[model samples]
Target: MTPLSPDDYTAIRLSLQVATSATIIALPLGFAAAYLLAFSEIRGKAIIEGIINLPLVLPPVVVGYLLLLLFGRNGWIGKLLNHFGISVIFSLKGAVIASAIVGFPLLVRSIRIGMESIDKQYIHASRTLGASWWDTLFSITIPLCYRATLAGMTLMFARSLGEFGATIILAGNIPGVTQTIPLAIYQYTSTPGGDQMALSLCIVSIGLSFIVLLLSEAANRKMARN
Candidate 1:
């Protein structure tokens, strides 16, 4: 194995940061969406579901381009953010947004499944016992679905850590700023005599993914036991 360079370390760190930020920002939103889908007979539910899952089915490049259109400097929201001195494109923050979009569907799916598995009778009981809607959700629904939420977060983190197409398009791959592991690996592979570095990064990515899967399985088992 080649000795990892400072750049490689930076890349790994940035990847983790991006993944963590993405997962954190997306978690509450995912849970809310899952809950809505699971419990509500709201109008346009199918349309909302399709929109939530669109990122998973659409090409990553397409998603990235859409983000650029919606969040780029020249875009509507982007211009507003810029007026407030917040920039999204070509920055680490942009990477986080890109990663979140890419991982959103998986997070939503996992949480939705968990919510669906919850017994509606429990909710009814909680309400009959005079629990408020928010209280019931926090005390019962959230605790019961915690394991699945964690699993969803783990999967989203893993997916975000290895994201390339969206990150590259939205964040511009600036080293130490937005260059994540996958982008770094791609860069290494393109340089002369950089195969070892690329291999090392590839191994790191695989290791991260493996750990996420193991943790998810463990969480599932624990939930099952309880």
Candidate 2:
């Protein structure tokens, strides 16, 4: 096997970092949205669902553009962040944000399905036992659907790892910095005699995706057994 160069290693590490960060940041929000859609009677639930899924259907470039408009140096939130000496545009942080936005729908959808599959009897029993709303959610609902939550997280991480268009548009492809595996692969393919590196990255991405699939299957099997 050909050893990867330092630049290639950096790209791999950065890709992992970006995807992990994206997954961590989005997980809670995804869970909350999923729970709300599954169990609540919130007003405008359909509108909330549409807004959550918007990034899935929108062009990646448009997502990036919207991110830039909302988080650019001079944009409202960006300007506020800048005052604190933080910036996301053209940075690894921006890549994380972009990936989270794109992967969010998948996370929410998986969790929603999980939540829907849960037996309502358990919740009702918990309520009858005098468990509070939050208590029932944490002790009953969430625990019962843990496998589904894991599946959602795995999918979100895999999706974030492969993110490209939004990453490039929002963060740019700066090697060893904002450049992730997909962005690096794109860069390699654009240069002469760089197919080898691109192919290597592609293989790594495929392996990662396969592992995620395996984990999801394992989770499903575990759920079925219970």
Candidate 3:
């Protein structure tokens, strides 16, 4: 049982920050994506869905490499961001972006599942009552899918906490900056006599994940009762 160093503490905090930020940032987009996929009858829907879920199938390192190419100085996005003096490579933003991308598919999938479970009768009833599309979405679709949305956020947050390969590649694992729990553990394991520290972080990660699961279940049960 090794005590955590200050850097370890920073990593813990950073992990929470990144996971929370990524989940919050992705929630609305995930919901919209889920809604579109679940209810839309547009052409090329399968292609859109496949593109959205690409991260889930691709290796994290590959995702990171592609991101790097897309955000490098010569990259189109990089050039655009540089116009505003904003940076992504080797920064906390990059870590958040990487985590968000890696965990996005899970969020979308969970919410989509939730959306699909809703009975069409409710939607039809809402429309029959003269509710507009936007009204139906906010008042009906969203309310019914609250549990799924929460589940997606939980999964994304947990996944973000464990993100490593893409984060390290895009964010460079800088201590007290882009370093997170997984990266910290990787760092410790790479150093001689650092096994204890790595194990300590691993324990912390397990605890965090367990807490997330418990909270998600509690929320779901409360939603069920309401």
TM-score winner among the candidates?
Answer: 3
lDDT: which candidate is best?
3
TM-score winner, 2 or 3: 3
TM-score of each: 0.96, 0.94, 0.98
User: Candidates sorted by lDDT, descending order?
Assistant: 3, 1, 2
Q: Which stretches of candidate 2 lie over 4 Å from their true place?
A: 1-3, 219-226
lDDT tens readout by residue for model 2, 24-63: 9999999999999999998999999999999999988899
How do the residues 115-177 of candidate 1 rate in per-residue lDDT, one tens digit apiece?
999999999999999999999999999998888898899989999988998889989989999
Report the Cα lDDT for residue 161, model 3: 94
Q: Cα deviation in Å at residue 169, candidate 3?
A: 0.8
Give the distance in Å from residue 12's predicted Cα in candidate 1 to where it truly belongs: 0.6
Clash counts per candidate, in order, are 0, 0, 0
